[model samples]
Target chain A: LAKTTQPISMDSYEGQEVNITCSHNNIATNDYITWYQQFPSQGPRFIIQGYKTKVTNEVASLFIPADRKSSTLSLPRVSLSDTAVYYCLLNAGNNRKLIWGLGTSLAVNP
Target chain B: EAGVAQSPRYKIIEKRQSVAFWCNPISGHATLYWYQQILGQGPKLLIQFQNNGVVDDSQLPKDRFSAERLKGVDSTLKIQPAKLEDSAVYLCASSPGTSGSPDTQYFGPGTRLTVL
Candidate 1:
């Protein structure tokens, strides 16, 4: 199983860009990094996913280094609605199970 | 297309009592999953089902937890004699393809179980 480590929490102000990084030193070659955001009393919602390099979507951008040992989720011009817990997950093509660690709780203040 | 649907948004029961949760996956989804999310912790996969067959239940406590997906559509997870440690949010998710495929999973609102 691949394990991920990220910050316990983060604080940001509205209109600022927030970046959360996760480290997975033992990640497999076929594993893909995925991010999810969860608000209070709700299930997690998928944000962005990437295999290598960078992948951008309307919601967020995912940047992966060449070693694939670490990945960063960047939220541009974040607002108070972006306040939530963000999770980093490794999805393996061969395995169906997903191992989730304690996510980084982001607080976007006005 | 509707996302995954779980009934009884909240449930409260005493220790040693029985409880059951129902889940209806999205139309045409072939893979279904059940997860347990404890307070201040991430979601933990409890079981996974491929169509109507059980694919994985390794993390599920078989002595007290049992889940079934009948006719490849709806699923039911039952716990006989619940424990205090079982108090958590039960989440249901579904995907269009199997685990080998790179498909995003759709999640439901989840059922919050409170075991007293």
Candidate 2:
């Protein structure tokens, strides 16, 4: 299992773009990067995932560098409702387990 | 499609007491997971079940925490002699059981457990 590190918290104004980056120095060969967002008192919801280069969806976009040592989650046009804790995880071989970290708590201000 | 369903959205219990939480995964989902999330922290995976069979439970406190997914559908997580440190939200999630790669999981509202 690879350990991930992310900023404790971040602040952004409404309509601004927010990027939360996570670093996993010990990532495995088959590891995939996945991100999740959680609001207060709610379960974490999937955001985006990528192995390398970039992956985009209607909700968010995930960018991974060539080294695969770091990944970034970009949220465009943030709103107050977008305030939540974002987690970056590594799905190792067989995808049986997901190692979680403290995650980045993003506060979107209006 | 109905999402994962969890019963008793909130539970308050005293230390040394026992409590149980129930979960119903999405229809056709073959994998179920139990996660514990403390305040201001990320969720910790406690156990994983693949169609009524335990796939991983290394993080589960077997002495106090127990979970079962019977009949490959609904599941229950029980805690015996709960402690103050056990206070957290228990989240249940399910995936479509894909091999060789990670599958997208759908989560429920979660059960908030307060141990005093």
Candidate 3:
């Protein structure tokens, strides 16, 4: 498994674009970048995933640079409901055991 | 589709007591996982099972924590003589067996446990 580094907290106003970046310098050849959002009392929900370049879904967009050392999650026109802890996950072999770290806490203020 | 389900939504016990939590994975999901999430931290995988057999339990504290999945349907996680640090949310998740990566897991609402 690869080690990841992300900011501890971020703040944004309503209707603004927010981008959360995660650095994974040790990403493996087959590792995939995935993001999950966790509310205060709920389990995590999938946001977006990508292997390279950019991948977009209805919920969010994931952008992985060509180097694959880092990735960014872009949320457009955020609202208070989008406030949550965002986790970046990678399955760098290791029998699919995910390395979950303390994620970035995003607070979307009204 | 129905998501993973966990019982007892909440549990409160004193130190050195025992507690148990149950989980029912999504129908037809062959892989089930148990996770512990401390306040302000991400979830830690405790155990993973493929059907009724254990797949990975390296992180499980065998001395006090035990989990079982019978008949490949539902599962139970037990903590004996619990400690104060055991107070956290217990989460259950399931993923399609054929998904291969097991990276995209569907999580339950989670069972909150507070040990005094």
Candidate 4:
């Protein structure tokens, strides 16, 4: 399993775009980068996932560099309801497990 | 399109007691997983099951915690002689079984257990 590091918290005003980056220096070649959003007292929901390059969905976008060592989750035109904890997951291999980290807490204020 | 379902949204119990949480995965999902989320921390995978067979349980405290998916659909996680550290949210998730498959896991509203 690859360990991931992200910010403890981030504050953004409403209507502003927020970008939360996760660093996984030890990410393996077979690993895929997945991002999930979690609100208080709720389960984590999938936001976006990408192996490389940029992948955009209706909810968010993921940017992965060529080295695959880091990835950034971009939320465009966020609202107050978008405030939540964001997690970056890395699945190393078949036998490897999903290791969770203290994710980035995004607080969108009006 | 029903999502995963977990029972007894909240539970409060004293130390040395026992508590059980139930979960029903999405229809046709062949893989199920159970996770424990402590306050201010991300979820930790306690166990994973492929159908009715156990796939991984490296993090499960087998001495005090036990889980079973008897029919390969609904699951029950039991904690006997609970301790203060057992206070956490138990989450159940399910996904299609296969490597390299584009199966995303669907999670249920977890069971919040408070042990005093």
The estimated TM-scores of all candidates read: 0.97, 0.97, 0.96, 0.97
Cα-based lDDT for every prediction? 0.92, 0.91, 0.91, 0.90
Task: Give one digit per residue, the lDDT tens place, for model 1 in A52-104.
Answer: 99999998999999999999999999999999999999997533778989899
Clashing pairs in 4: none
Query: lDDT by residue for model 4 over A41-65, one digit each (tens)?
Result: 9999888888899999998899999
Q: B1-116, model 3: which lDDT tens digit per residue?
A: 78899998999999999999999999998889999999988999999998898989999999999999999989999999899999999999987767545356889999999999
- Report lDDT (Cα) of residue B31, candidate 4: 90
Model 2's i-RMS, to one decimal, reads: 1.6
For model 2, how does the per-residue alpha-carbon lDDT over B39-116 read when each residue is reduced to its tens digit? 877888999999999999999999999999999999999999899999999999999997777788889999999999
lDDT string for model 1 (B14-112, tens) is 999999999999999988899999999999999998889988899999999999999998999999989999999999988887556567878899999
> Arrange candidates by lDDT, highest first: which order?
1, 2, 3, 4
What DockQ does each candidate score versus the true complex, computed on alpha carbons? Answer: 0.63, 0.73, 0.57, 0.56
- What range of 10 consecutive residues in model 3 chain A has the weakest lDDT sum? A91-100
Candidate 1 residue B70 Cα shift, in angstroms, is: 0.4
Model 2: pairs clashing at backbone N, Cα or C within 3 Å: none
> In terms of docking quality, how is candidate 1 classified?
medium
Cα distance off (Å), candidate 2, residue B90: 0.6
Fnat for model 2 comes to: 0.77
CA displacement after TM-score superposition, residue B113 of candidate 4 (Å): 0.6
